[model samples]
Target: TYTTLDIQNLLAGGAGNPIGHLATPAASRAPGEDEILGRVTLKYEPTDRLTMTLKASYDRNSVNNSSWNYVAFRCGLGSGISQLSGYACDNDKFVTHQNNMPADIAANFPYAKKDGQLYNRYESYAINGNVNYELDNITISSVTNFNRNNNRWTCACDFQSSNNATWATENSTWRSFSQEVRALTSFDAPINLMVGALYQKTRRNFGQWVAFAGLRNSAASPENQFVATSKTSFTKGETTALFGQVTWKIVPTVELAGGVRYTHETKDSFFTQPYNNPGVTGIFRDQNDPDGLGVVNANQTFNNWSPEVTLTWKPSRELLVYGAFKTAYKSGGFSNGGINSKFSTNPLADLTFDPERARGFEAGIKSTLADNQLRLNLTAFTYKYLDLQVDFFNSPIFAFQTLTADAKTRGIEAEFEYAPRAVAGLNVHGSLNYTKATYTKFPLAPCYAGQTPAQGCAAISAIDSRQNLNGAPLSVAPRWTGNFGVAYDTDLSSTLKLGTNVDVRYSGSYLASGFNNPLSRQSKYATLDAGVRVGAWDDNWVIALIGKNLTNRLYVSGVVDGPSTGSGTGTAAGIPADQLGFANLPRTVQIQLTKRF
Candidate 1:
């Protein structure tokens, strides 16, 4: 549900619960986002054999995501005043609301804070130049690029209704430069070749403020008290790569192609929050201030090779078949949720992770039939992914972390486009895919609420919690997903035309949290969308009206575990609620007007 609800006593035979998330129940007002971008390009051809192109761009975006809030019921010792309804409440979720004694800090309390969920601003600039020279049957090209980005964001780390966590913010800057040079041969020979080399360097600086109030189940941060921990970090990286590709046309209807790339990369980062003081009184210092306490700096190098090979056959002008095998790699990096106390207990959480790698193969066929009226394609693929990067939201820490896992997956995809001869202005297109993805090794996946010791659940707070998920499916919906769309266009007059389209999408059930969280499961659903367009037969102006999600399916798109919620104990342990759900947008309509230049 988009809004949170207090379902303590209202489930079976109780009276009812309260609503959450939305601040103005009777009104709707949203902020306006602004974005600006400018670009310029220049091209020159001084000689018949040489050409040069240069482009530069600047972009800025300001966003305000401060319109969301939520209220939830947690387990407290006895009963306390309900913050949302101002009512007295024992155990809340499935029992009576209770509060704690004067001495007990863990009291069942109401959590219903509102507004300023998030805000962000970003600005970037880029400049790129390309040079190409042609000689005989070979063409040599070089590309150089320089880019910079500055970004900032703030969040009310506390998702509850209380002002418990008015503390999370970040500022970051990144600068990068890269250059690549390659030569390609386009000779009318049986063999073709392409070779390239690339070098890149990037530098980044970041700073963040952790939750000053800290995450609590039934409590808010001390008023006028500032316990925010300040942390700053930096990263520097350099990479060099060499790649080449060869294509051999063995026969008129058969061909073979292969390519390989070797990369050497080095990374250096200050991954520790040395300035963070894990005491009752936290120091408010920035990253620039020299206060070295903790220790988790990363200075590592990695080498990898990526290769791909393909063979193709064409039996006729309209039919083609191909198969290929490929390998890929992604470098690992540090995380930046600031100094987390859980890291002290689970040192691995603060350490750098291994690189992620994948090897896969695919076979596909493409065909056109019925006098160019039909086009169809099909592909089957399988892959083994090692050290896959997975993102998790640690509700207690109000931070995001990246974990690693090993997975295996196989899938098939099919698509088709058709234009019936009987209907000159009608077209139909659709695609379908089915995948089976499973975690071959994931011993420390986050457990859902209420998971017990028998379930291999363990925790040092929600941020460092884990459970066994080795045999679970990697994707929530590992079955079938597909979409079908149809469009029709007809000329109404010599200068006007009418166009209409309808699309439908279907998906199997999946977990909103991506992990195997039972409480965050989303049921199988389908949606319908349709649109109408009218224009002066292309050359001028056009108007379009579109309706999206006409079925108005109510489903959760993602979730964040509530405070101490994923500790696997749940409210039964007098903690926070299981999870907070973010719902997908409902049915909506839009009207657009366009003019061609």
Candidate 2:
């Protein structure tokens, strides 16, 4: 697959430049990918009450692209015109450009590099086996799975330089094994029960290397080129769990079900980084540790219990209502970098984050009306989260950090499908959702840069404290979302058929940061998609012409607040005030052919 990207504001003149935009057709950004997948399955039944199955699959994917973000240089340009004077702009900002172009006024203007060059390759394979036995009203099953993956990635940190650009490479290997056993019982009475036990183990090895051209050139010899930094890490984890569920038919039209699961997990990790030069440090490290002896070795264990209860009522043959309450939790883990690297001496304590827990309640109804021609479903839910984990990039330190906070979310979802009995192969469907999510209790949260005490920043807080986000809306949580679509199909001939579909999707504006900065919010936007399909040979083979985002709507898919280029100081540290991230993909059209065997 190949696709082009549009980096907004890659040029100094935004969209009014006469020389042409940065992402013009002649200089459009393109990314390419190739993937291959294979799978096989086998099933056997040796007896009336016994069955066995085996499955295996493999996948490999390779991706190559330019920079993910077109970071602009902060050079001061007197006018947005072409000039060749090297002294026309401040050298401090002009030098930030990675390309080899001369530091002329024209070159100083923000221009997105056409080639930054990043490549990634991933390969994985898995095998699974299942066995089942049944006797009378009881059934037993067992499953086993093993998987392994290898990943490699390389990228140029600086795009402008031909042979002197900064670059990084990472390699990772992961392996996992899992087993599960379960038993189910169904009695003559109105009751059913199931119990299961599961165990899993995983291991990972990762390493990264970074180098700079300037440092390499400064080396004593070409054979001893500089190696700014290198990192090596290893992790191992194991988990054991037991779960059970029971359902009882309390009455002719009512049923109640309950389930519980308990899990115990253990994890161990080791990390170390070596600085090749005594004066040089890793991007995530703020101190100069010449010995490169900074190491993180830690082990931790956790145990959790989750439970759920549900009540269902079938008021009639065509109508059903249900309510449920559940409690869930996610395992805690150690941070990979950021603040954790800064506190290398006690990484276990400073870089570790607690598990996330949540309690939720939901009620929903499902109904079929108009002689089964229409189906509708509606649901409302609310949840309270404790220690919700969040990840943010720390511009001040030029690293990423993981944090936890408490939050609450309430939402409603509705969906409907209509197919008039009078018209065959004609159907309409749609769905709508509304979400209200906010931080219920959060202290010591980082405030947006430039935010004052009166504007929600804490007057006096902890070392890293910024704003009090107790009531701020959750990041990426849009309030309103909806989708509508219609499809029609008809017989074109005895063995041929034609089908067409159209869909519209819309989303409301919402904040993109925990600090609720207005600048980080993305306004509402909508897109339309359409497709036509032609089938032959009793629909065994089909071809489709599909068009997505037909309107060519320009919008941001996501945002991360920060400076467009180099890190800033003071209140400008890390905030979405600067729109410098990758833009969403433009309109796409494709033709697809599928066959069934």
TM-score for each predicted model, relative to the true structure: 0.79, 0.82
CA deviation > 4 Å runs, candidate 2 = 1-29, 66-116, 156-166, 217-226, 282-293, 337-346, 395-399, 449-454, 458-465, 562-577
| Top TM-score model | 2
lDDT per residue (tens digit) for residues 1-597 in model 2: 000001112212422121211211111233356889999999999998999999999999876633433322111122421122222222112121223222121121112122323556889999999999998999999999999999876554443223333455667899999999999997887899999999999998877665443343233233223344566777899999999999999998999999999999998987666444333433334233543436667798999999999999998999999999999999887654323344234444555668999999999999999999999999999999999998765443444566789999999999999999799999999999999999998876766644545556553523343566888899879999999999999999889999999999999987655667665556788999999999994768999999998887655544443223212212323222332223455578889998877
Kindly report which residue stretches of model 1 are placed more than 4 angstroms away from their true locations once superposed: 1-32, 47-49, 66-118, 211-227, 271-295, 338-351, 392-401, 454-466, 536-540, 564-577
Please list the C-alpha lDDT of all candidates, in the order they appear.
0.65, 0.65
Tens digits of per-residue lDDT for model 1, 43-158: 99999999999999999986553323222322222235433333332111212111111111112211111232345678999999999999999999999999999987654444
Q: How many backbone clashes are present in model 1?
A: 14
Evaluated with lDDT, which candidate comes out highest?
A: 2
Clash tally, candidates in order: 14, 8
